[model samples]
Target: MALRKVLQQLENYKSEKPNRVFTMYLNTDLADQDQQGGEWKIHLKNGLNNFEHYLQKDGDSDEKRNFWAVKEKVENYMHEHQKDLKKSVVIFATGEGDIWFSERLQMPVQTAFHWEDQPVLDQLKSLNKQFPKTGIVLTQKEQIKLIDAELGAVNDTTLYELDLNTEDWKQHQGPHHADSNLGSGGVKSSKKDELAERFEENRSRWYKSIAPKIDQYAKNNNWDAIYLVGSSVEVDELERNMNKQVDDKINKNLLDHEEMKIIEEVM
Candidate 1:
């Protein structure tokens, strides 16, 4: 789901009586200086225990029961996704299951926990503003990758490959592995250098041909910003040809890297 829609739903929600919402933002990034010793584990345990202790001391029997139920669900979810956890995890859940939203994000988040009538969304809102909806274009010789992202998570990816036979661009949806020789047609090793030279000669024209396609995609997806990543020649050609304003450019060939790694570097 879109982050905006999720935030709207949380904004509209308000727990009644014994049913309160649980909001958690847990940082699981081991590379973080403060989390080198797995400090987040201790933080999570203490956060949940503090809530339980509070309800036990001041809440009625039904509220206490609701708190316990929510706590169990939260703990089970963390355990199940522990292996796949990314830099951070955010969740908003209710005891009765009216609201259940969980995301393991590639971006870092400050650890927080709350039990209240409404979901605590201040930090999440801040993240949304910081990241927004962005399109990252990774351009190489005969390949172009467009990544649609929001809130430091990939929503979708579109790959455009140059079809040498037809001299046209072919679009493929979702993640794809990079082809070292996209349209090589199994050229002999001896001729590889010649092929590279020819590609360089036509590089600018080829990139310009796809510029309109990228602009149209950005318009259709309502991208807040566009980034170009590749060699100086490749990115410069693409940025010059495209009508949309390029927000930034990175002089690195990241088309073959993992999506999360690309995001981490550029974002």
Candidate 2:
């Protein structure tokens, strides 16, 4: 589900009396300086214990039972997903299973925990605004890659390769592999130079042909912004030809890089 839809649902949810919700945002980024020693584990344990202690001291028996139920489920979820954890994890769940929203995000988040009438969503809302749904267009030579991403995670990717025989763009489902032919030494230098010159001369027309497809894709995906990344000429041509507004452009040929790395560099 889209983050916006989840946020909407969460905004409308409120726990009834005795049924408090559990919300947690944990930062588990291994590369972060403070997380080098796996301190998040200690933090998670202490945080859960604090909540349990508070309920035990002041809350009714029903609330205490609810808290325990939520805690156990939360712990199980954390343990199951720990191996696949990224930079952060956000979860909003209730004891009765009325609401269970969990996500592993690539973006870093401040660790926090809450046991309250409603989900704690201030940080999540801020993240949605900061990292809105984005379309990243990466181009190099005859190859173009379109990345659909939100909150630093890639949701989908489409690769377009120019068919020399047909002089048309052929669409592929994902970022399968880099165009090895671009760097292969099998082709004669003169032929390669000739192809390069031809491509340079027809760059504008070529990009123009694919621009409408990209614009339609952005519209269909409801992208908040579009970023273009490639050589200066390629970026400029693609940006100029596209109907949608280009939010930013990076003059770097990152078509061969991993999707996460591309997100890091552009975002």
Candidate 1 residue pairs that clash: none
Q: How do the residues 148-199 of candidate 1 rate in per-residue lDDT, one tens digit apiece?
A: 9887788889999887667688898998985545566766889878867977
lDDT of 2 by residue, 92-117 (tens): 98888898999999888999999999
Cα deviation of 71, candidate 2, in Å = 1.3
Candidate 2's displacement at residue 151, Å, is 1.3
Model 2 off-target regions past 4 Å?
A: 180-190
TM-score, per-candidate, Cα-based = 0.86, 0.91
Residue runs of model 1 more than 4 Å from their true location after superposition: 178-183, 189-205
Which candidate comes out best when scored by lDDT?
A: 2
